[model samples]
Target: MLQIEDVLRDRGSRYAVSGGAVQGRAGADAFVAELKRVKKFAKATHNTWACVFSDLGPVKADDGEAGAGAVILKMLEREGLYDHIVVVTRWYGGVHLGGDRFAHVVTAVRAYFAALHSAQSR
Candidate 1:
């Protein structure tokens, strides 16, 4: 299992990104299980996540972050990533970022992929 953590701060809000590998086609239930394994993000304002399980297909959840989940899902689809799950936990700073929030989510996913590549190369 691979994992990386990153925090993206913008508009007074902080987005904590958790990128990890999903063993086989773990399904949505396994996605939730992986999330429970991490205690830090449990209390986040929004824990939007997306996963690509090639065997079972792709699944995503908004967790109250609106279209943020879709943003991550699109990235996963573009990369053609398989057996991977990326969770972005946003701690709302009481400020609305509007469309800009989508950009931040993209950044988080990109960072995760980069990290995943670097890890594999090593």
Candidate 2:
């Protein structure tokens, strides 16, 4: 099965940016900027990204790393942060973090959004 280790290798962070339309050319630009910022912060060499932007809603995922990117994107969607954005960045650590460990990292990043959602809901 596909795993995180196959995608991410080390330190990473996920951030969401809201307050703007997440579709069309403008949305794509914003999303790219967010992706760059997150990648810069993580000092990641590679980045996979995906987005769903439309009148229907905003959704996206990176297909570069296949399953790994898809999984991360799904987690972001579950956070329910609409009219917003999410980017997952990773910095290679040289040592393999394994599939389980990698998934944990993705989960941890998603948890940040969960916390944000919880705080906003209150």
The numbered model that scores best in TM-score is 1
Using Cα atoms with residue i matched to residue i, what is each candidate's TM-score against the true structure? Answer: 0.85, 0.54
Would you list the clashing residue pairs of candidate 1?
none
Q: Who wins the lDDT comparison?
A: 1
Question: Which 10-residue window in model 1 sums to the lowest lDDT?
Answer: 23-32
Q: What's model 2's overall lDDT? A: 0.47
Per candidate, the number of residue pairs that clash is 0, 10
lDDT of 1 by residue, 54-115 (tens): 77777888988899988999899999887778887788888999998899889888888888
Report the C-alpha lDDT of model 2 over 65-120, residue by residue, as the tens digit.
34555665566576554545444445545555557544754654555565555666
How big is the positional error of residue 122 in model 2, measured in Å on the Cα after superposition? 5.8
Relative to the true structure, candidate 2 has a C-alpha RMSD (angstroms) of: 7.3
Q: What ranges in model 1 sit over 4 Å off? A: 1-4, 23-28
The weakest ten consecutive residues by lDDT in model 2 span 1-10
* Backbone clash tally (model 1): 0
